[model samples]
Target: DMYQMISDDNPYETPMMIFPASHYTMGGIWVDYELQTSIKGLFAIGECNFSDHGANRLGASALMQGLADGYFVIPYTMQNYLSDQIKVPHFTTDAKEFDEAEKAVRARIEKLMNIKGTKSPDQIHKRLGHVMWDLVGMGRTLQGLVKALAEIEEVRKEFYTDLRVVGRADDLNTELEKALRLEDFLVIAKMMAIDALNRNESCGAHFREEYQLADGEAARNDKDYMYVSCWKYTGDNEKPVLLKEPLNYTEIKVQTRNYKS
Candidate 1:
């Protein structure tokens, strides 16, 4: 892109794109004590697995999680799981299960390629992004969240039915990649809105407009809703089941945060 002549020519000038990210809400995929996800061999480490940080994670803590997960944690934990699998025999891509999975993936790709719509994946994705930002990004309310869910559903429907993938699936197709990722992004956006709606009280990154005090602060209802709410993905356009893992504090007591000085 620099060579494409859109960026600042000067070396001392600011870069093309820079942004703050991953400070808060550093984790999402539910993992066990050993950082293993529901899929047996698939392990989520560092920020990928929901652990290590409080609701609002400071930037510095992500560094520790990264180091700990990469260096110390995943090695011992993954090895434990792998040790048992040593005698299970190595399976290649030619296996029956892998063949079926690959066929399903190729079928999805063909479906996207066959959509033959006018809008690019980027265009549809941008529209989806705008909907999320305006409706569900911040200053969220009951009505807004509900509307966001509706909009996201439309986006999801549009993605599957109207998305145009410009390149061949057999080749290295970046547009196809974007289309696939956009599908997942739509899922995340909907899940976020759904979870926001489920949790009645405002807490951390989820700042519901209805769940606020007169002085304009988050009113966290620990007595009723103090728990890690994990989601079970049902299907496209179906409501995700809310799986709540209640937080029972043993070492410390629950305390309200007073942000006002």
Candidate 2:
């Protein structure tokens, strides 16, 4: 019976394995109407900007948004911002700000190299990947999220102590690069858990097991949670603070979607 059904219109076998993983984060650095981030003199576009997609992007929309922002939006908006600065003198690397930024980066690199502990960056990252995949990915519960947060802290501690990176920082060190990237990922993972914990209601890709309806579908709480979450980083190892911008729809009425017909 299964073979007959499969032979009717399907091109592959019935039994198969489906693996899940994060494709892209629709939530990213928030941008304004002009495609500029909150910080002045800096701009972000494409997958890095959060303004295009709400929580979950569908199909080819990511490509379309990227192209439109690159070709149409930024060209005009950035020109306006740059119009007044045309007469400004070019900045030299000898400037204080540049020196400080470079020094900070070098110090961070040295710190990572000096650890010289047992576990490699890849090992710690693999443990982190498991924590994220199991506790924070797809299915989520309050208990699981709390566990993930705690486990992330423990992994972060391990990373700071046991992280081993071979090669010199002055040169191109692939292991150092991975260690740095993993360092960033650790913080971002914590932020994810925090945001997930704050938003008790489920919406888009951020599904919470405690906020489901009788039909096992996500139950959105628009009355209380219709806002974009923004986080402000405060120093090293401190918890990020949250700020919300309420979503306002003037032309469209918010309604539940039905895909079954």
Q: Number of the top candidate by TM-score?
A: 2
Instruction: Specify the poorest-scoring 10-residue window by lDDT in model 2.
Output: 16-25
The residue ranges of model 1 lying beyond 4 angstroms of the native Cα positions read 1-27, 92-94
| Predicted structure 2: lDDT | 0.83
Candidate 1 lDDT over 1-261, as tens digits, reads: 342375546435653343234335334577888889889999988766666764466566667888998999898899899888968987788889998998899888888899988889999999998887787765678999899989998888888777888978899999999998888898898888887788788887777888899998888998889888889899876778888888999999777766664
Task: Please report how far candidate 1 places residue 110 from its true position, in Å.
Answer: 0.6
Deviation of model 1 at 213, angstroms: 1.8
Give me the runs in candidate 2 sitting further than 4 Å from their true place.
1-21, 24-26
Best by lDDT: 2
Residue 159, candidate 1: C-alpha displacement in angstroms: 2.0
- Report how far off residue 57 is in candidate 1 (Å): 1.9
CA lDDT of each prediction against the hidden true structure: 0.80, 0.83
Q: Please give the lDDT score at residue 251 for candidate 1.
A: 97
Give Cα distance to truth, residue 114, candidate 1, Å: 0.4
